[model samples]
Target chain A: MSVEPLDPSTLPEHDNLPGNAHAYCVRLTGPLFVQTGRMIAHYPAGGGTIRFEPLTATSLGTLVAERFSSPLYSRDWVVANGQGHVLLGDRGYDINSYDLDEGNLTVRAANLLAFDAGLELKESIVPGFLTLIGTGRFLASSSGPVIFVEPPVRVDPEALVGWADCPAPALHFDAGWMGHFLGAARGALFGTRSGEERQYDFTGAGTVLLQSSERLREDPHALRRLEGEVRQLGPGALQQLQAVVQQQLAEHQQQQR
Target chain B: MSWRLRTPRVLVVDLDGSRGSAVRARTGSMVACEGEVSFKDAGIGGGGGLRAALKQRVAGESLPLMEVSGRGSVHLAVEAGHVLLLELAGEVLRVESESLLCLSEGLRTDVAFTGLRGASSGQGLFTTSVTGHGRVALLSLGGPPIALRVTPRTPLVVDPDAYVGCLGEVRQSFVTDVSWRAVVGESSGEAFSLRFEGSGTVFVQPEERR
Candidate 1:
C-alpha cells in the first residue's frame, strides 16, 4: 500500500502514526524540552521559524535553570522554542507518552525522549535515571513495548525501565543460599543460568515499567557518576582501584574469547 | 509501484518475462525466485560505464549492483531492513550508496562528490545520484524513513547520521554550532549536522548510523 507523505498539516497532534511505535509527531504550541538530536523534523503551522537553543545558553536561561535541575543532562538537552510541529524518533525504539497529574515518574536517562516544560526535571537518586515531577506529559522510549506491573514484586535489573509514584527499589537476592550450596554439593554447581539470583525488589505501592527486550544503551550518566565517585579517593587508593579495574578488564577480555 | 511486499523486510518484484526492461539490484541481494530468472553482475560501477566506475572507485562510494532479468516473482531483502518504495519524476535523488536497494531500467545511477559531510556523517564523502523517471526502493536500518518537505523559507537542519537521502533541487551544507557542542564532551556523537535549503524532499531514518 502506498502511504501518503505527511507534512505539517496532515500530521497527527500529540500522537504517533497508527501502529507506528518508532516515530512521534507533536503539535508544539509552546516550548518543549527535547533530548539532543531527537527532533528529526519540524513543520511550522504558522510559518514561524523554530529554533533549538541549548538548555544551558538559551535566552530562557533563567527558566531553564529552574525547570531543569540536573547538570549532567544540561548539555544533552535543548529547548525547542517557537511555533511548529516537531516530529521525534529515537533509534527505532517504541515511544510512549504518559500524562502525570501532579505525580512523580522516574525513567532511565537515555530512554527519556521529551517532556513538557511544565514538568520539572531532576536527577533521580538512582544513577542513570531522571525523575519528572508536576502535572504534564513526558515521552520515553523502550526497546520493546513497555509492560506495566504493580509493585510488591521483584523485577530483573535489565528489564526494569522505571517506576512511577513509588519508593526506590532495593537489590533483592533469591534468599536461598543454603539451597544453592546444596545444589553445588550435588554437582549441579554454580552458574547454571537460572537467572534467579538477583533482582530489583519493588515494594510499597506504585507501578513499575518493564521492557521485554533486555538490550541497553551505554549509560553516560552512570559513568559520570563513577567518575564523580572516584574524586573522593586518595592517590594511593586511586592507583589500587586502577589495578583492580585493569584486572577486571583483562578478565573481561579473556571471557570474550 | 506495482511491486508487492512479501514482508515488511522483503520486497517482491514480478518481472515481465518478455520485456527488455530490467531491474538492477544490490549485489547478492537476490534471496528467492519463483520463475525463470537470470542474475548477472551489472559490472563496474553498477552499469554506469567506465567513467562512472572510475568516479565511484575514486570517490569511495561503491554501489555494487547485479542485473535481474526474466519473468518471475523475486524476493529481495538487505540485512532485514525495512524497504521504502519511492516514485521519482525527474528529480535528482542523492542517496548514500549503502541504502540504495534497487533501481528501474530508465534510472541513471552515478557517483557524485557530496563534500566533507560524508566523512563526518559516516555515509561517505560521495553519494549515489539517481535521476530520471522510475521507482527507487531504499533500505533503512529502523522503521520507515521520514520524508520531510523543505522550502526556501523553511530551511531544515538534520543530524548527518540519520540522513538517508534527498530528492529535488536542494543545496546541503554542513552546520555545526561548536560553542555549545564543545561542552557536550566527546560522546555527543553528532557535533556536526547537515543543513538543507531549497524546495524538495529529504528522507531521514529514525536511527543514527553507528
Candidate 2:
C-alpha cells in the first residue's frame, strides 16, 4: 500500500492531522468557537467564506452574545467565521490543541473540540464541566491521551477529564462507602451498591484532566441541568420525588432478579 | 495487488495456493487465514453479475461480500476502524458500502444513484462504485485516512457526518444552508454539507458517522 497524500498544500499549520491524533487542522484567520458538528473538511485559503454562526445567529451576533456565556452550552456552540482552512473532527477522540496563554481551562463539555473566538465561555460548577476563560486557541476531545495529573488527585468519576487551575472536585466517598452511608441497614444495603463508591477528589493547586477512557461523553447539558432542577420542585417536592423514583424502580427491578 | 498492512488496523491478503488465488472479503471481515483458504457467499450481488445483482437490491447498497480465495494469508479487520490502502488504476472508487474493506480479484462492485444526499443520511441514496484494476481496503473511524485535495479551484466542504470515500472525478454538491436549517437540533450533526468539486481524492474520517 502506497500511502502519503494529505494535500491542502501540506495541511497542519495549526496542528494535528499528520498521522492524525483524531484529526484537527485549523488555519482559519479569525473567529472559531466551532463545536457545531465538528466540521470535517474545509478549504478555501483564497476566495473567503467559511461561516457556521449559530450562537443565536445574526452574524457574530454581539460577539456570540458577548463571548458565549453557556446557556447550558449555548445550543452546541458555533461561529467558525470567515477565511479558510478549518477541518475539525471528533468522536474518534484524542484531539488536543490547547494553548490558552491567558490561562484557565476546565473542559469536558463533551471534550470541547475547537475554540478561539479569543475564548471566554463559562458555566462549570462541575456538572458536565466547561470553563475556558480567555486567551486564544482551544480544541480538546479525549477518550485517551490527556493525562496531565498533578494535584492531590483522586479521579475516576468516569475518569474525570477537566481541571486546569483547580478548585471544583470534592466528593470522594469511599470511607468504606462512608461507613455504608452512615448505616441505616448499611444505607439500604450499600444503597444498591456499585456507584464504585464515587471519587473525583482533586485538592488545591492546578491541572487534572484525565481520560484514558472511562467511556463517558453523553451529557446533553445533563438534561438541561435536570430540567433546571425540575423547575424548583413543589407539589410536596414532586410527590417526594415520585416516591423516591418508585423505590428506585423497585430496587432496579430487584437487582434484575 | 499483494496488500500488506499487517496492522494500521490489520489487513493481510497474500494468496498463492499454487497459483489459484482469490480475495473479496467484508462479510464478517476475515480476521485470519493461513494457506489454502476458502469461505463462500460473495452472494446476492458482490460478485457483480445478474445486473450487479439487481443493482444491489435496488440500491439500498448492501455489499456483504466474502469470497476469500485460496492459498493462504487473509486477515482483515473492521470495527477497530482505520485501514485505508487504495490502489485502483482505471479510476472510480465512490464507496460507502460501509466503507468497503477488501477487494482485489479484478475489482468491479456497482450501485450508484447518489441523489438527495444519501437519502438524508439514513444511508440510502446509494453509492458503492469500485471499477477495474485492484487493491482497495478502506475502513476509517476516527483516524487514518484524511486525503482531501479536490481541485478546479479547490472546493471541498465535507461533513455529512464526515462522509468517507471518494477517489476521483469528484463533483458532489448538497450544501443546504438556511442558516444551516436554522442551526438545527443545536448543530453538531449536520444541517447538510457534502460539497466536493471535481478532480478527485477525498476520504475523510475524524469521527462522525451519524
Candidate 3:
C-alpha cells in the first residue's frame, strides 16, 4: 500500500511535540492530535487524518531550541486563560494554569533566576535573580545543580544572583562608561575590563530564561543606587510604599483584565 | 505668801506669782494678767515693731483644751494627759502648730491654718483677731502627709489636694488651669500655665485626676 504526503497548509500546527509520545500527527482539514500521555488535539471538519511519525533524538533537540528561542505569546491574557500568572516584582505568582506542562524552560538572561516550578521569579533593581518556590523540574543556563523543590519552598533569588560567565565579562560595566562606550568607541579605554574588575558571570550548565531586553547587571552602579533608595526607606515606610505600589499594580491588572 | 508655777512644756504665769491661783477671764475664754512667758512669733509679721507688740500679748501656759462640735474643729492630743482643741468663732490668724514629725517636743512647733474660710460665704465678712505667738495643726485626707519645705531660695508647685502643711511666714498663691486641652488634646495650642515665685514649698500628688 502507498501513502500520500499531507500538505502543511491544510494541517493544524503542533508547536512543541512532547517526548513521551511514540508518534503524533494532525491530518489536513482534520484534528491535530497526540497519543503519548493521552490523545490531545483539535480537529477541523471531517476530512483530516493522522499518521504516526516517531520523533528522533535530533528532532527533539531541534524542538527544544525552537521553543526556548521564542517568547510565549497569547492574544488572550495568559493569566486569564487560567494557565499561569505573572508577577513582575517581589511578590509571588499565583498560577492557576492546570493541564499545562512545562518544557525545558530556559532562563539565560542576566540576573534572572526561577524556582517553584518557574512560577515565582524575583526581579530586583540591583543584581537580578530568580527564586523558585514550588517542587517542580527547572533548568538554568548557569552551572547550578537541578533543584527539585517540595511544596511551600522559598528559593532566594540572590542565591542564583550571578553574572553569566563569558569572554566578554566587561558586558557588565558601570552605566557611565558603558553609555559612553556604546555611543562611540572613543571612550572605549575607560570601558570595564575583564579580570579583577570584571563583571560577575554565571556559566556552566542548565537552560535559562532571558528577557529580550537588557539585563539588570549591565549597569551595576545604577542598580545599586536604586536598591539603596529602596533599603533606606526602612521596613515601616517600605510597607506603606508597598501598599501604594500594590495600588498601582491593581490598576495595571485591571487594565489588563 | 506667793509661789511660782513651772513645767517642762510651758511657763505658767500669775500676776501675784501665786501657784494654782484663779485668773480673771476678761474676753470670752482668754485670761489677761501682768505676767511674762518665753515664746516665739512664727506667723507673717508686718514689721519689727508690730511683730514685737503682737508677741507681748499671748499667754504661753498650757491652756485647757476647749471642746468644738459643729464643723472645722482642730484638736491635738498633747503630752501630760492634755488635749488642745482650738474652737474658731471666726477666721483664726497668726498661729503655728508643732510639726507632726516632732510631736515629742511640744514647745518647739510650726504654724498651721484652722478655719480660715467658713463653709457659707453669705456670712458678712467675719474675721478673728489674733495678737500672739502660737501654732495650729491641720489634717489632710488621702495618702501619707507630705512635707513641703520652703526656703528663701527654694520654691515649689503643689496641687491643692496634696497641701498638708505650710510655714506661717511663707506667702501662698493659687494656681489653676492644667488640663488635657492644654497638653495632649487638640486644643493644646491655647494651653494655660501657672507661675509660682517666692519662698514656699508646694506638695503635689502623683495622680491628680483622682
Candidate 4:
C-alpha cells in the first residue's frame, strides 16, 4: 500500500542498468546486495517505495549488491562470500542468487504481490507474492501463481496465454498423423491434437505472467493477413485500422501498469 | 405397431401410445405429423416434398396417403403431437415446423440422436440433413430467426455434423491426403479438413464432434 521513498544520492552503485527508465535503489551498506525491477523494497526493519535513476555500467555491481542486501541487512543477517538471503515481507521470501560473473544476482521473491520491469511493485490482493529477475518479459496476470523458472528459454505467447507458471508440456504427434488430418505431408509444422499441450498449466490461486518469444510465431499467417488487409485499405479504412491498433496498444499499456 | 420403409426412402408407422416415433423419406417426399416425431436416416438424397394427410386413420377404413414429394418420405404416428419437419438443401440446412416442403435435389440427408447433459435431460432424436445450394429455413423454439451473412473474402469453417447451411459458393479441400496409416498416426481423425476457398458462407454449431 504505502512505501518509504529512498534518496538517490545515498543509493548504491550499479552498472549497465537501463538508463532513461526509472529505477528504485535500496541501500543495504553491506558486501551482499540485490537490485530488482520493482519499486516497493522491503526489509525486516521496514519497507518502503523508492525511485532511482538509471546507473552507469560501472556502478552496476555495487547497486546490485546494495539492493540484494537491503532486506537481509536490516534483519541483522550476515553477508558471507558476498551473498545474503532474506524472507521477503510477511507474505514471501527472497532467494537472492548473486552471480559475480554476471555482475547481477537474481532476486526470486515468492508469495507477495505484483511486480513489473518498470521498478514498480504493488501488493497483490490474491494470496501471492512477486518475483523479479533479470531476464524474460514482465508478466502480469490474475490467473494463477507458479513461476516456472527455465531461463534462456523462449515460448509462444498465444500458446502461453493460459500457462503462467509451469514447464511447457511435451507435444506429441507424428508427421504421418499430420498429413492424414490436414491432408499435408508433414505434421511437425502444425501441432497435432488440439489440447495436448497442457504441460504449461500453472496451478495456484494467482496468475502466471510470462514473456515468450514463441508468441511472435503464433498465427504468422493471421498477422500477415491482417497487415495486408490494413495496407490494402484506402484512406478511410486506414483510419479505422489505425484506431483499432491504437486501442490495442492502449490496452497493453494499461495491463503493464 | 410401426412399419419402417428403408427402401423407397419412406417409413409408415402407427403410434399406439408410445412417447417416441421415427420416420424416413423416400424419393424426396415430406411428411407432416400431429405429434413430435424423431427423424433418423441412413442417408437420403436431397429435394422432395411432404404434406399432411387430410384423412385421419380410423379402425377399419382405407389407409390415408399423405402427399409426399422428393425421393423418399417417412411418416410416424404419434399421440397428441406437434409437427416438426426437417429438410436438407445443398449448402443450407433448414428446419421448418409450419412451412410447406419444396426442397431441392442437390443436398444430402441423414438422421441422428442427440443428448444434453445436466439436470432435466433425455435423449432427443432429430433429423439432420445437409444441403448443397439454396436457402433452408429452421423454425426456432423461440425468438426471431437470426441471419448471419458470410461472403467470399470472409469464409467460415464449421463442423460438418453441426453444419446447418452453406452458400455453396466455396470449394472444399482436404488439409491432407487420405491414407489408412495416416489416420492411425497422430493426425488421424483430424487429418481431413474441409477446406472452403472462394466466396460463400458455411453455417456451423458451437459444438462439433471429431
**Best by lDDT, which number?**
1
Better of 2 and 3 by DockQ: 2
DockQ for the candidates, in order: 0.41, 0.25, 0.00, 0.01
As for candidate 2, its interface RMSD to one decimal place is 7.6
lDDT by residue (B1-210, candidate 2, tens digit) is 367887798888888753335778889988777877888988878888788789877666788898887776888998888898888899998888887888888888888876775334555357789988877888888777788888877778887667778888977877777676787866455677777777878887888886
- Model 3 per-residue lDDT tens digits across residues A19-78: 111112222221111111111111222232122122221223343233222121111001
Fraction of native A-B contacts kept, per candidate = 0.27, 0.68, 0.00, 0.00
The TM-score of predicted model 2 comes to: 0.37
Better of 1 and 3 by lDDT: 1
What overall lDDT goes with each candidate model? 0.80, 0.79, 0.26, 0.29
Compose the digit string of candidate 2's lDDT tens values, residues A114-211. Answer: 78878888888878877888788788887878888889979777777788887888887778767766765744764456777788898889888888
When only the first chain is scored, the TM-scores of the models are 0.87, 0.37, 0.24, 0.23
User: In candidate 3, which residue ranges exceed 4 Å CA deviation?
Assistant: A1-257, B1-131, B178-196, B200-210
Best by DockQ: 1
Question: What is the full ranking by DockQ, best candidate first?
Answer: 1, 2, 4, 3
- Say which docking band candidate 1 falls in: acceptable
Model 1 complex DockQ against the native: 0.41
What TM-score would candidate 3 get against the native? 0.19
The better candidate by TM-score, 2 or 4, is 2
- Candidate 4 chain A: minimum summed lDDT over ten consecutive residues — where? A83-92
